[model samples]
Target: MRVKSEIWIRAYLRRCQAEGVPAVVVRRGDEAAGAIFICVDRLDGSVALYGPAPAGIEGGETERRWVACFKTATASGAEVSAYLARQSRFDSDLWIIEIEDKQGRHFLGEDAIIE
Candidate 1:
């Protein structure tokens, strides 16, 4: 028997939601690209996102665009969370997160974050 990824994805998101995780579906344009989320499974504020592997010169480029949009937030240090939540790209589709660093890095954590 084969399992549909979209089905599993929804199940995962629902489980994450019940667990009080802050998960969101990251979309690019209007297609479901991926997601950036977090859950209680993580002790630190690590963020977990799942999507297509970064591709094309436009991969990182797309993330940069989102970074700029997320800059509008004035939080002391919650861009990762704010970004995944307020990003408008998901208004239609899912976008990929490709940047990494201490200031901000997309970490695949143990917990789940749902939107």
Candidate 2:
């Protein structure tokens, strides 16, 4: 059984808050199973995006390897925005979270595959 999208998002936000990282939900999607996309603003005039992996890629893997966690090399705001806009168009129900951190800490915890 998977955790509902909204519940997972709320928990993520709380975890960020506890760690003193500024995080915000840029866009909200369906409460049930919408895919989550995180935008990390490095605060150095650059941003990067991350999203979950497909079922085929993550299935049968450990929780730590569930998400593909692809990262865009830090780029200009316009470039990041353009990429995100394209994604938003393709998935209207996608949830977008923006995290402002100088070190690019996404607070993904231990259950993420950061590659």
Candidate 3:
């Protein structure tokens, strides 16, 4: 079975803190099963957004996969905000996590497949 959304998010926050990265949950969603979106602020003018990958990508059913939300490697803050607004309207149960790292580290590891 898959891990609950709340449990996964708490663990992820701990991991980020351990790595010395400042991360915070901007918006809280369902505790059971909610889509997660991550925003990596580069501390510059650009940002990177990652959302849950489509099913049957590569990871197992119990694993959470992510994909870049933009065509380019990074996008403007305004652009990211607009995309996230649309997403929030579509899925109110989606969680939003923002990480402030000058290196633009998302810490997604092998679970992320940039497209």
Candidate 4:
């Protein structure tokens, strides 16, 4: 069984805080099983977005995998916002977490697939 979305999110927030990184939930969704989307604001003009990896990606069954949304390493804030807006419309239950860091650190560890 997978951990509840709310539980996972809370733990993630705590982890970020422990690392002295400023992170917050920009949008709340279902507490049970909502997909999570992370927005990494580099504190510059560029931003990076990470969303739940699609089915069949190789990873632990209970682990959450993420995929970068943009083809480039980073994209403009407007571009990411527009893509997120479309995603929000498509999945209202999805959760959004925003991390503001000058270094653009997402803190997703090895679960993130950039390519």
Top candidate on lDDT is 3
Clashes per prediction? 20, 0, 0, 0
- Candidate 4 lDDT, 1-115, residue by residue in tens: 6788899999999989998999999999999999999999998888999999998877546889999999998999999899989998999999999999898888899999999
Candidate 2's residue-wise lDDT over 2-114, tens digit each? 77789989998999899888999989998987778877888889776677766655432423223433344666778767877887799899898899989988777655555
**Model 4 — which ten-residue stretch has the worst lDDT?**
54-63
Q: Candidates' TM-scores?
A: 0.29, 0.83, 0.96, 0.95
Error of 2 at 68 (Å): 7.3
Q: Number of clashing pairs, model 3?
A: 0
Write model 3 residue lDDT over 1-115, tens digit each, in one string: 7799899999999999999999999999999999999999998989999999998876548899999999898999999999999999999999999999999899989999998
Cα error, residue 103 of model 3, in Å, equals 0.8
Clashing pairs in 2: none
Cα lDDT listed for each candidate: 0.37, 0.75, 0.93, 0.91
Model 1, position 68: C-alpha lDDT score: 25
Give lDDT: candidate 1, residue 110.
26
Greater-lDDT candidate between 3 and 4: 3
What value of lDDT does candidate 2 attain over all alpha carbons? 0.75
TM-score of 2: 0.83
In terms of TM-score, which candidate is stronger, 3 or 4?
3
Instruction: Order candidates by lDDT, high to low.
Output: 3, 4, 2, 1
